[model samples]
Target: MAVDDFKAYIRKIIHVDMDAFYASVEQLDDPNLRYLPIAVGGSSKRGVVAAASYEARKYGVKSAMSGRLAAKLCPDLVFVKPRFERYQEISKRIRDIFFEYTALVEPLSLDEAYLDVTVNRKKAPSATLLAKEIRQKIREKTGLNASAGISINKFLAKIASDINKPNGQKTIAPDEVLGFLETLDVRKFYGVGKVTKDKMYQLGIFTGADLKSKSLDELQQHFGKSGAFYYQVVRGIHLSEVKTERQRKSVGAERTFNDNISSEIYMISRLEAIAEELEKRLKKHGLAGKTITLKIKYSDFSVQTRSKTLGLFIASKELILEESKALLYQERLKNSVRLLGISLHKLNSEQNSSELSAKEAAAASRKHEQLRLPF
Candidate 1:
C-alpha cells in the first residue's frame, strides 16, 4: 500500500513486557538466585540460552547465544533448565489480569502483549494509569516486575514500553508523537534490524529526523517494499489497530547451532529434540495438525522448508520425527546446516480437545485411587 493511503489513527494502546520472564521466574522460585547472574537453559556446548538475568546481561550474555559462550562471558552464570508448564501457568495469571480491564487484548508472546484501552471495562481516564494498575497487579500476584508503554498506537506504545527497564512505565501522548519520534535513533524504530540499520547509516539516515526527510518514493527506491513503511512510521502515521483475535496457523520449534553440521546422525538428534518440543506445545494448546513441516537453515543463512500433509490430524512426537526425517532426506543438502525446525499445520482443535480430555480423565482416576488408599 502507498504511504498516502495509510489511515489516520490516534487510539490508546498499551504494550506490556515482562522483565526477563523465565529468568525472573527462576529467581522468584528461589530467593537465593536473586542478585546473581543466571541463565535459563544452554548448559551444554550445543544448547542455546533461553533467557538471561539482568546480571548476566550486563556481561553480554543473551538468549540465542550458545551456552558455552554465555558461560564464558559470565564465569559465574548459573544455568537452569526451562519449565514451560510453570511459565504457562504464570502467563495465564497475567492474562486473567488483562481481561479484567479490557477484552481487546493481543498477546505478542508469553511475556508481552498489546492492549487497546481507548474505551475499557473500568472506564479508566488514561492508558498510562491503566498501565500502572496492570503492572502493579502483575507484581502483586506473580511476584514479578512488568514494564509498560502507553501511546496513541502500537508502534509508539511498544517503543515506550522499553524506555524504562524492569518494573517501569512510559507514555507517549498524542500531541507529542512527532517530537518523541524525531529524537529517537533510526535504529530504535520498531522494524529496523541490524542489516537495515547499517544500510540506513550508510545512506545518512541516522535518526528518525533524518529518515523523515526522505519521500516515500525515495525510501521505496532504496529499501524496496519496506521503504513505504519506514517513511510513514517516522512521521507518526502507523494505522494498525489492536487485534483481539490472533489465531495460530501453525506451531513450531527450532534450534540454531553454534556451528554447522554435515552429519546426518547429529541432524536427526536435533530434529528429535525439535519434534519433542513441538509435541509439547501441541498438547499444551489442544491442537492437532495434519501437515508437518521441516525447516532447515544452512550455515550461509539460506533457508528451505519441506512439508507433508496426512489424511488425519495427529499430535505425536514419534510421528513428527518420522515425517520430518523423510522430509530431511527428500532433498539433497546445498550446504552444511546450522538450524533445524519442525512445525505442525492444518490444526484441528476439536480432535485435540478430545485427546486432552482423555488425558485429564486418566490423571483424575489416578488421583482418585491415591485418595482412596489408606495411609
Candidate 2:
C-alpha cells in the first residue's frame, strides 16, 4: 500500500484515563476530603500510597511512595484506606458508558481504558467530539473526571492522554502525528522509564527526532528487543490494537514489613501467609499455574525474583506454600528483607485462551484496510 493509502487505514483510538481515580473517589464521597492532599492507602509506617489526589501531587506525593515519605512530603496529607470494591463499582459504571458508544473497549485498569471508535455504534463522524461526549457522560453518571486522547493508534493515543491531564483531552491528527512525535521528549515516550531515559540520554537520544535518526540494528544493539519498538513508535507507526478481552498473565500477593526482617525463620512464616493469600486469589479466579515465583525486596530497595516451573499446575494453599518455601530456600538472602511476594504464572487460563500473539494481532490488523475516520 502507498504511504497515503496506509494512513487512510488509521484507527480511531481513544485512551481515557480517570484523574487520580482512587483518591478522587474518596474526595467525592467525603466533602471534607475535597481540595485536600489525600492518599488512598494505609497510613502505617510500612504503608504505600496507591493513589494521590492532585493536591497531594503538588507536594511531590505519588503512588507507590511509602506512607512515611508521603507524610514527610505533605504534613497535612490524609491517608484513606483503599475501598477496592467501591472503585470497581465506579469502574463498571464508566465502562457501561464506553459500551454505549463502542464495544471495542480495552480496559488497562480500574481507572483507564482504550476505546476503538473507528466503527462505533454512535456512528460519530469525529472521534475527538465523541471522546468529549463520553467524558461528559462519565462525569454525569459517576461524578468523576476523565481525560482522553484521540489518535491513529493505541501508543500515540495513550501518550496524548497525559498532555492535558486531570479532566482534559487532546487529539493528534494524522497530519500532525509525525511532527508531534518528532519534537516530543524521549523521557515522555510511553515505555521509556527513568532507567531507559537515562540510557537514551547517554546515547544522545533526547528527543523523538533523535530516536528516529537511529537505525534498527543500532537500536537493537542498545535496547535489545525494545529497540525495534522505540524505532517504530518514534515514526508514529505503532499498530497495537484495542483488545477487548485481556488475559491475566499472573496472580500474586505481597506485603512490606514495618521493620525489615533478617531471620530466615521469620521470612518462612511471612512466606506462608503470603502463599495463603496467593492461593485465595487463585481460587477466587478458578485458576492454577505451573510456574511459582518468589519475589524478594531488600532494605536497599533492590529486588530479586526466583522462579521454578513444575510439571503440574497447582493452586491449593499447601501446594503454593510448599513451592514458595522451596523457592525461598533456593537462594540465600543478600540483605535485610523489606518485602516478599509469591506469584503463580503459566496459568491454566493462558492455555485455554486463544489470544493472538503481538505479531499475529499486528498482522490481523493489517487485513482491515478501510478504517477512514471523518477526522
What are the Cα lDDT values of the candidates? 0.84, 0.88
At residue 198, give the lDDT of candidate 1: 99
TM-score of each: 0.83, 0.91
Q: Taking the tens digit of each residue's C-alpha lDDT, what string does model 1 give over 34-112?
A: 9999999999767889999999999999999989999999999999999988998999899989878876777888999
Per TM-score, the best of the predicted structures is: 2
Weakest 10 consecutive residues, lDDT, candidate 2? 350-359
Total colliding residue pairs, candidate 2: 0
The 10-residue segment with the lowest total lDDT in model 1: 366-375
- Once fitted onto the true fold, the runs of candidate 1 whose alpha carbons sit more than 4 angstroms away are 1-8, 254-277, 297-304, 308-319, 333-339, 346-375
Candidate 2 segments exceeding 4 Å error: 5-9, 350-373
lDDT, residue 100, candidate 1: 80
